[model samples]
Structures are given as structure tokens and as C-alpha cells.
Target: MKIEVSLLAGQQLKASFADHEIISDQSISAGGNAEHPEPFDYFLSSMPMCAAFYMRKFCQQRDIETTGLSFTQEVITLDESNPYKKKVSMKVTLPTDFPKKYEKAILAAANTCTVKKVIQATPEFEVELVK
Candidate 1:
């Protein structure tokens, strides 16, 4: 998959991938228009969203009800010495009346996020100016 990122004046940037377009901006204090989500916001959201997709699939396959299901994600920087990502955690909340038997399976399913796996693998990236 290929993505294109373009500057749109000031500190705003637009990223286009396939049929989707995501706008990234900085806060006024950060010298941006604050018109859209910051780049870090997208990065943080990717994990939970990917997990949620698998969670939904798990429920659908098992004929489980998806009402009142939600998740919370938290990021913690363990060591400032290690720049970039330090730690990411997610908590999946099931409905009060959710079946107890599926708890383990649900947790397992949510942990199957492809994004999380990729981050764990720590893929290498190469950056170069486009000619």
C-alpha cells in the first residue's frame, strides 16, 4: 500500500491512502491551525481500532452480542532515553451482563490487533526525499 502526504500551508499536512484522506495539524501553541487530528493521534488510535476490528469479528463469529462493548487505550513513556514509542496498553470493557465464559477469548481476540503485532515486530523504515 502506498500513501501520499502533502503540506497544505502552515503546519497542516494531508495524508491520502487509497480512498481515504486524513488531515493532520498542530495546535496553535505548536504553530499549527489545529484544524484536524495531530499525527500522534492517528498513530495512537491505530492500535485500538485494529484491535476493535478483530474483537468485532470474534464476537460475530461466536454469535456474541456487541452491546455496551468499549475499549480504552493508554500510552506510557517508560524511559525518556528511548525516544519514539515506549509502551502502549489497551483495556477492553465488556457489558455488565456479558458472558463470563467468553472473557478469556475476548481478551485474546482483542490482543490480535495487526497494528500491535507490527509494532511489536518493530519494522524498519527508510526515509528519503522524493525527487
Candidate 2:
């Protein structure tokens, strides 16, 4: 999958992936960012969303009925020297009727979220500053 982002103007950006489009601006506290979600938020959001995606699929495959699902993700930076590096914790909430027998399996499915796997596996990328 490929995503493309283009700068629209000052503090404004646009991103496209497949059939979807996203617009973002700087934050009011940080500056003027339109009504769009910040990049950092997306990073944090990806984890829970990914986990939820896999969880839903896993449940469906197992004939489990998921009445509801939600998640909260928090990131803690252990070292200020490396601000980009941090650890994330996710709290997942599911419907009360979710089967107790499937708890372990569901948790395992959450662990397989694409974003979780990416963070844990630490894939490498090459960075180049272009003029």
C-alpha cells in the first residue's frame, strides 16, 4: 500500500491513500492546523485501530459476536534524548457478552495488529533530506 502527502500551503497538508483523502493542519496550541487530525495522533491511533481491525476479523472467523469494541492507547517516552522513541500501552474494551472462553484468543488476536507487529518488529527505513 502506498500513501501520498502534499503540502497545500502554510500549515496545511493533504494525504491520499487508495480511495481515501485526509487533510490536516497544525494544532491551535502549536499553530494553525485546520480541522484535520495531526500526524502524531494518527501514529498513536494506528495501533488501536489496527488491533481492532484484526480483532473483528478474528472474531468473525471464530463465529464470535462482537457487540462493541473500543480502545485507548497511551505512549510514554522513557528518554527525552530520543523523543521519537517511546512505548505504547493499549486498553481495549469489549462488550460484556463477549465470550469468556475466547478472552485469551481475542487478546492474542489483538497482539497481531499490523501496527503492533510493525512497532515490535522494528522495520528499517532509509531517510534522505531532499532540497
Candidate 3:
């Protein structure tokens, strides 16, 4: 649940969490080597991925087949005055044969994603320089 991030060469950043490491970097045009996903990419991906996890869990508990389950996320920018994402759309595709009874439950499960709740709540942050 804890992550430590440090600057690497150029615009690369390394983040370590739960005994694993992940890298983030800008594109070559953005002064980075583009070796890994950029910070914003990770931010945008967090919601859908979290929801997907819950969706899978919901299917598993119901003994439902998940062979064709898919989730795609898209972001829309509101205006030039705001450079951040204004809206996020997540599309979930279930197998045609999937049970109709579980459809609403599945959607509810996806809404349980913690990251989505955090984003909606707009948590506050405290930043300070430490030595």
C-alpha cells in the first residue's frame, strides 16, 4: 500500500511498491526515452483496471464464464481551460450468452472499484520538501 518514487535519468521515474518496481517516462518527443508508460497513462488506466478486477471477481463468485469479458476506458477533455480529464467512459463487454440476471450486479460490482471512488471524491493532497 506504500510506494516510493525517485527520479531516474532524463525524464524517467521509478516507483517501487510492494516489493515490485514500475517505471514511467515521457515520449522521445517529450524528452524521455519512452521505455515505459507515462504517469498520466498510469493515472488514466487505474480506474478501468480496478473495475476490471472487481468485475472478474464478481464473475468468478457467480461461476460465470469470463472468456469474452472485456473492458475499455476512454477519457474526454472538457476544455482548453482545464487540461485534466473531464469525463471517463468505461465500456464493459460481456459474452452474449451471459446471464441477464447478473448484468446489473456486474455493473454494481464495477462501481465498487476503490480507485473510481477516490477519483470521484477528489481527495486532498499535502506536498512538502523533505530532506
Candidate 4:
């Protein structure tokens, strides 16, 4: 999967991934001129979505019935000196009727989620300037 982001102006960017598109703007407190989701929100979203995706697949395979699911994340930036470094904590909520017996199974599945694994492993990236 590939995503592309183009700068529009003044802390606003247009992002596209396949059929989806979004505009990301930095927070006013962060010196952005527009009101839109910031990059941090998008990073937070990826973790939960990854877990949800795998949870659905796991439930299907185990014949589990899920009426609803939701997740909340708390990201703590430990060092103001390094804004990019942070810790993410997630709380996953399943339906009330979800079987208790499968709790471990579901958790195991969540652990296997691609984004979760990536976060845990702390993947490396290479940055370069292209003209």
C-alpha cells in the first residue's frame, strides 16, 4: 500500500491512498492555519484500525459473534525534546456478549496485527530529499 501527501500551503497537506483522500492540517496551537486532522491523529488511527481489522478476521475464523467494537488510544510523548518519540497505549472494547473464553485468542490476534507488531518492533525508516 502506498500513500501520497502533497503540500497545499501553510501547514495544510492533501493525502491520497487509493480511493481515499484526506486533508491534514496542523493544529492552530502548532502554528497551522487550517482546522483539520494532524499527522499525530493519523498515526493513532493506524494502530486501532490494524487491531480491528485482525480482530474481525479472527472472529470470523473462530465463529465468534461481534455486534460492535471500539478502541481508544492514549499516546504519551515522554520527551518534549523529541516530539516524534512517544508511547501508545490502547484500550480495546468488544461487545458485552463476546465470549470470555476467546479473550486470550482475541488478544493474541491483536498482538499479531501488522501495525501493532510494527509499533512493538519499532521499524526503521530512511529519509531522503528528492529534487
Worst 10-residue stretch by lDDT in candidate 1? 81-90
Model 2 worst lDDT run, 10 consecutive residues: 30-39
For model 4, residues 39-130, the per-residue Cα lDDT tens digits are 86877788878888888898899787767766667888989999988887877788899898888888787777787787678899998999
**Which candidate number has the best lDDT?**
3
Error of 3 at 41 (Å): 0.5
Q: How many residue pairs collide in each prediction?
A: 0, 2, 0, 0
- Cα TM-score of candidate 4: 0.80
Compute each candidate's TM-score over C-alphas.
0.91, 0.83, 0.94, 0.80
- Candidate 1 to truth, TM: 0.91
* Most accurate candidate by TM-score: 3
- Ranking of predictions according to lDDT: 3, 1, 4, 2
Tens digits of per-residue lDDT for model 2, 1-131: 89899988767788899999888787888776547788777777888888888888988998877777666788999799999778787877878888888888888988888787887798999879989
Off by over 4 Å in 2: 80-82, 129-131
What's model 1's lDDT at 66? 89
For every candidate in turn, the CA RMSD to the true structure comes to 1.5, 2.2, 1.1, 2.4
Off by over 4 Å in 4: 79-85
Q: Per-residue lDDT for 50 in model 1?
A: 88
Candidates 1 and 2 compared: the better one by TM-score is 1
Name the lDDT value of residue 48 in candidate 3.
93
